[model samples]
Target: MLACLLLAQLLVAFIGRSVGPLGVLIGEDLELSKSQIGMLPAALFLGQAIASIPVGFVVDQTGSKTLLLLISLCVGSSFILMTFSHQFGFVLFLVVIGGLGYGAMHPVTNRGIIHWFQRTQRGFAMGIKQTGITTGSALAGLVLLPLAAMYGWRQVVAAACLLLIMGGVVSYTFYHDSIKETNQDKKNLASFYGSMKHMVRNKPLMLVSISAMGLSGSQLCLVTYIVIYCYEYLDISLFLSGVLLVISEICGSIGRIVWGIISDRLFKGKRVIILMIISGIAGVTSMILAFLPPSTTFGVMIPITMVFGFAISGFNAIWMNVASEVVDTTFSGLSSGFSITLGSLGVITLPPLFGFIVDFFGSFTAGWIMIVGVMILVFMLLLLLLLEIKTRAAY
Candidate 1:
């Protein structure tokens, strides 16, 4: 079941993340500005934000298997259809359709983990599951970019979507709901309004969710612009620039597992300290990026990108675990959904805003600074959350 969930996440995440490596191709073909290119991924996140709460509610009511199957087919078809469209608006529209499918992914997968794993093992389980995301993005950078360069982005997208459809079918065949629904369990399901109220009142969860907005936004900016930044600013080839994304993602994948182990084994289920450490690393890295010289070597950039990826990209597993654990197990999906919805707000807005700042200032420095500021704010929020936790323990 964990393997199936991971595979499903990997397939769906590919389409959304493909925008990063394929941005230059799409922009040149469509005659899009940087801001417009940023909008493509933002649109995807918008779909996610729109669908998250509703999907969360549905996943908690139904099981994850059915929803996972539906999203795979539906999102795969949407991206396949997207390949047929030449107009930017039409392509963006289809991306949103694909994003709607993605919105349900977290709620479904997190619910599965909550059902299958005990708290002692959940951080590592969630980490392994979250690696699917980084691995998918790495695949995009490693495989899709080269294919798009050789065969055109449209062909690559269509081919990938087909695989996604097949993966969905396979996952549906093997994955079953771990938790059987009883009459009592069904009866205890809260109304949507009641669930929202409970989630909103979860002070630590709410703080974490709000802080995540910054992290999500900063992470997206890194993914969206790093290729372009390397190519244009650092005088790297497009292929090599894409390789940098692959490196970050691969490191991010490793970081997810390491951080999870730290939380689960070393910290004994503690997550906020991990979050604060991640925030600090991300902030420092962003500061380096803000002041990076054009003459900086590719070797220097590699380590910096690795650290950035380790924090901004790798923090999700810990964040998701914290969010789900704060609420009742029955409402885990709802809590995950709510956190994602808030996180998506940052994902939706930050990339384009980063682009706009770049365009306005004619430099990446301000944009990196913006990300740095966001990380600082996230660290402060985590500090407050830690204080709150201590206060409650004292009481």
Candidate 2:
């Protein structure tokens, strides 16, 4: 089941990230400005944000496996349709459709982990599961970009569609819901609006969601622009820049596992405090990245980028786990849905903002500063969350 969930997430992530490394090529082909190119990811995230709450309600009615299967088909079909996109608007439309499919994986898969794993191991399990995101991004960095460079972008999308089809088959064959639904769950499902109302009233979950907005904004800026930053600003080749992205994602994958172990063993399930510490470290690294000397060597930049990736991208599973723990077990999917929807506000807004800063200033420095500032804001919010949790515990 864990493997199935990971595979499901990987497929969705692959579809979502396949365009980032190829951004330059696509922009050249389509004659798009940086801001317009940035809108591609924004449109995708907007679709996901639009779908998350409704999909959460659907997951509560159906199960993760069924939802996974349904979205897998949507993702596969969207990729194939992407092969025919000749205009920017059409591409954006396809990306939004793909994003809608990609949106449900978190709430669905995290809910699965909560059901399938024990409390003692849930952090670690979530950490392992969260690697699906980094893994997918790494694959695109390592494989998709190279292939798209050799063939065309259309061929790359077609090839990705084939893999997504296989992923759909794997999901249908192996994935199963661990939770056995009760009659009471069925009765409660009828009051979906009440559940949404209660979710709005949960202060901790609301704070977590808001914190996610900041962290996600920074993280998206990093991932969406890292390749372009390296290639355009640092005088790196496209292929080497893609390699840097792969390295960052690899570090992010390791960071998730290591951070999860720390939360489980060292912190004894105090996830928010760990998040607070990691967010501080991440904010520091983002500031450092923004200050990298123009003559900096790839070796120096490599380590910084790795640290940034780990610190920025590693804590998501912990956040999801913390959100789940704050609410009733039955509301795990709904709470994560709220977090995802709210968190996606960053995704919907940040990339184009970053691009606009770069285009206006004619350099990446200001954009990088914006990203780091957001990280600092994220750290402050995490601190508040930690204080609130501690105060409630004292009561």
Deviation of model 2 at 97, angstroms: 0.8
Per-model TM-score versus the true fold: 0.97, 0.96
Please give the RMSD of candidate 2 to the true structure.
1.5
- Mark the regions of model 1 whose C-alpha exceeds 4 Å error after superposition: 180-184, 187-190
Model 1 lDDT, full chain set = 0.90
lDDT per residue as tens, model 2, 25-56: 78888998888878877887887797888787
- Report each candidate's C-alpha RMSD, comma-separated, in the order given: 1.4, 1.5
Per-residue lDDT, model 2, residue 170, is: 94
Candidate 1 lDDT by residue in tens digits, 1-395: 99999999999888778987799888988999989999988988898998888888888887888888899987899989988888999999998998999878888898888888999899999999999888888899999998999899999999999999899998889998874422215424447788899899999989999999998888889999999999999998899999999999988888888999999999999899999999999999999999989998788899999999988999999999999988888888889999999999999999999999999999999999999899989999999999998898799
Query: What TM-score quantifies how close candidate 2 is to the native fold?
Result: 0.96
TM-score of decoy 1: 0.97
